[model samples]
Target: MKVGIADTTFARYDMASDAIDELKKRVSVDIARYTVPGIKDLPVASKKLIEEEDVDIVMAFGMPGPEDIDKRCADQASNGIINAQLMTNTHIVEVFVHEDEAEEKNLPEVAEGRARSHARNVIKLIKSPKKLIKDAGKGKREGYPDLGSIRR
Candidate 1:
């Protein structure tokens, strides 16, 4: 199967590369890559990758700037991604890293860890759907820390 990697140029770093490298160790799939200006561009890029490149799946990576507006843009992009997935009948695994994930305690590592983790999930989705079946309704909180019961 072919996989697509769509990342943003606005990112402080290229976490998508880390994910691709991690995926290479387990699967031998063709890769289609596209770099956009920011998170907002990911949805279109992902759709093109699926529709044009004909990829089986897509991995989306982006780092929102340290601002509330950036987070809002990310949220809008996420909604678009879902629409794109439904429209294309494909899966686009999103891996986003916020600039303020952790004050100054090495956010790059956090981004890398999350990107890689989601990459593994992509592999699992193709290789073992049963494993992810139980995760239904968990929402897309993969990279972020589990806050657990935000509102009781």
Candidate 2:
């Protein structure tokens, strides 16, 4: 299988590279990599990886700023990825690290851990998606403490 990485040119590019390295330990897969200027550009880069490079799956990684607009832009990028996945019949795993996901002191650690975990997730998703099916609705950031179950 092939996994493409669509990464942004920001302070967190290392996180994506870290993900790639972490992924390699579990699976033997071909990698195609692309770097966009920023988070907003990730979708198009990911689309090209699928449509042009013919990768089986894509890992889109970005770090949005600590602002409302940045979050909104991340949402847009995510939506575009979803659309591309539907249109092309592929999976584009969205891995984003917001500036506020952790305390300022813990941001670096959380970001690295989250990216690594998500990379492993990308591999599992491609290999045996059923194993992860039950957690489809259990949305939580990868590197954070488990928040436990929510009750309505």
Task: Please provide, for model 2 over 1-152, each residue's C-alpha lDDT reduced to its tens digit, 9 standing for 90 to 100.
Answer: 89989998864536888888898888898999999888878888999999899999999888898899988998998898888888888899888888877677888888888889898888888999887877765755587865655768
- Candidate 1 structure, TM-score to reference: 0.87
Best candidate, TM-score: 2
Q: How many Å off is the CA of 112 in candidate 2?
A: 1.2
- Estimate the Cα RMSD of every predicted model relative to the unseen true structure: 2.9, 2.0
Residue 64 displacement (Å), model 2? 0.5
Question: For each candidate, what is the lDDT?
Answer: 0.87, 0.85
Q: Give me the candidate number with maximum lDDT.
A: 1
* Cα lDDT tens digits for candidate 1, 1-152: 68899999999878889988988987987889999998999999999999999998999998898889998999999999999999998999988888887765788778888988888889888778799777665554555664443334
